[model samples]
Target: MTYTFTCKKVPLSDSVKEYAQKRIDKLGRYFQDDPAVHVSFSVEREVLCAVEITIRSGSTILRSQSQAVDGDMRGAIDSGVAYIERQILKNKTRLAKRLRSEGFPSVVEDVSFAVKEEAEFDIVRTKHVPVKPMTAEEAILQMNLIGHGFFIFRNASDNAVSIVYRRNNGGYGLILADDME
Candidate 1:
């Protein structure tokens, strides 16, 4: 996979970069095509290191981020990669369908799992609303006006369904649906 690294208020050494490349290269086995991997490293108060990794193939994206205490960059990187791996494992079937629909080769193989107890959430309520076409700004406005945490609508620009949500950090985030073949 191709890698692009960015450092925020932190300098990366050649050895660190090489280490990161080696670590991320191991993930290439999961993709038929080499995906673009973007990695960002940041330092917080000189005591913590944050690592963000994003893998992009066509319109699908898998991302993970982690912060390591005591400024351990390697640990942060490892944690981020593990998170992505877990995500892929959890959604392997869904990802395979998406890949095939998008004309991409499937990279996951079926594996038997040992039964284990897992937490479950009961559905308490369900509400359905007609998705209206609107710009992202309009969706954000509607979400704020309704005092709702998120609003769903069809994106005017792409004619695809989209979601606008209020972020915990006092900002809005947009999730656009990618057109698949």
Candidate 2:
């Protein structure tokens, strides 16, 4: 696995970088192969150190972030690496569930989990008279009525797609995708 280390507001040390790279490289033990990990270290408020680790393979992404108050940068890096490893384990359980649901054929030498792909087309489905604006509560009701997991509607305030969907806790969750230039 390849590791990329980037530092901000702090001088990069060879020892610190090597320690982080070696620590996260252990993630390969849980799976058949390891995915490349990206580590970003930054200093906020010139005192607290922040590290963000992102492991990506194709369409799948696993990320974890942590911060520490130690003056030593190596301590923060170690904490971040531990956080990332824990996150990967959590993701492994999720992958196991998906494999059980969709069926796992074989465990190859590479990343053992299979990635599912989905595509959406932008065409006319069932046209409506007017795209009415409503609150997230209304969207949840409409989604339940249509027997769909999610319902997208224009927010009366921002005119954006604010989605409401069923959660495993028997409650609804709202997704508000932001629009940025």
Candidate 3:
């Protein structure tokens, strides 16, 4: 397994490394044989602290990133990890089917899904989305793996159509549909 840290504007400190270690350990089980961990820390305008964490396990890879507008690295890491956990729990079945890891949970419990009530307005609107269950993290990995600047996928989090693209800042950005009207 390899661990990599990238620092920009913000220096990687012992405390930050320690905190990152703690954070990644929370998702240790998800990692497979010889997993590679990459974390990027950056500061924008000397105010915002941004972090992007990428974990590669065998042929399966996922990336989760969080930014602290207040420039708190630790908080950003916590939020990023929480996002990953939620994604894992929500798509536990989907992920398990795709990724063969003993650390992955077998059952999908306490899952939440929205229920839309029928309306008798005689009008219904629908948009086509990729049925493949994938999160933003997977989208990014796929994008980079293919050497593409951007990639689009169905967001497993909210079932929203989303796009992940590379930014000029050496980081990635996600765009979600805001309005269909």
Candidate 4:
């Protein structure tokens, strides 16, 4: 796998770079094709060292970030890689399903990880609601009136489906679905 490293507010040493590359290269065993991996190192509050790793393969993206309490970049890198591995393990079955159903290129190798029995997720409730065409502002108002965190509606301007939700930062976020083509 190819690795691109970036440093922010911290001086990257040759040894640190080599260490990170070697550690991240171990993940290549899980993929059938080499994925592009980007790692960013940064120092926060002049004490905490942070590392963020992003792996991109075809249309799938895997990302994880970790901070070192002891200000060790290597530790942060290790933690980030471990987090990514856990994410891969947790979503292995879902990814395989997507590969079969959507025809997406498989980044993972079938032989690398053991396939374990996955817990079933049951859908207990189903609700059918009319998707009303409305502006984004009107959707937000409706969401607030209904005391719900999010409201899904058809955008009046484009007649496309959209979702408006209240953000944790006391703001609003809108998700508009567009054609990939």
What ranking emerges by TM-score with the best candidate at the front? Answer: 1, 4, 3, 2
lDDT (Cα, tens digit) per residue for candidate 1, span 104-138: 22443453332222335469999999999899999
Q: What is the TM-score of each candidate against the true structure?
A: 0.69, 0.51, 0.57, 0.61
Sort order, lDDT high to low: 4, 1, 3, 2
lDDT of 2 at 139: 80
Q: Ten residues in a row with the worst lDDT in model 4?
A: 97-106
Q: For residues 34-65, could you state the per-residue lDDT of candidate 2 as single tens digits?
A: 56789888888888888888876544566777
Show the lowest summed lDDT stretch of 10 residues, model 3.
Answer: 112-121
Local accuracy by lDDT, each model:
0.80, 0.68, 0.76, 0.82
Those runs of model 1 whose alpha carbons end farther than 4 Å from true positions after fitting are 96-126, 132-138, 154-161, 176-181
Count of backbone clashes for each model? 0, 0, 0, 0
- Which has the higher lDDT value, candidate number 2 or candidate number 3? 3
Q: Model 4, stretches more than 4 Å misplaced?
A: 97-118, 121-181
Best by lDDT: 4
Per-residue lDDT, model 3, residue 72, is 85
lDDT of 1 at 87: 67
Tell me how far the alpha carbon of residue 47 in candidate 1 is from the true structure, in angstroms, after superposition: 3.4
Q: Candidate 3 — which residues are off by over 4 angstroms?
A: 98-102, 105-181
lDDT of candidate 4 over 127-178, digit per residue (tens): 9989999999999999999999999999999999999999864899999997
Query: What C-alpha lDDT, on a 0 to 100 scale, does residue 23 get in candidate 2?
Result: 78
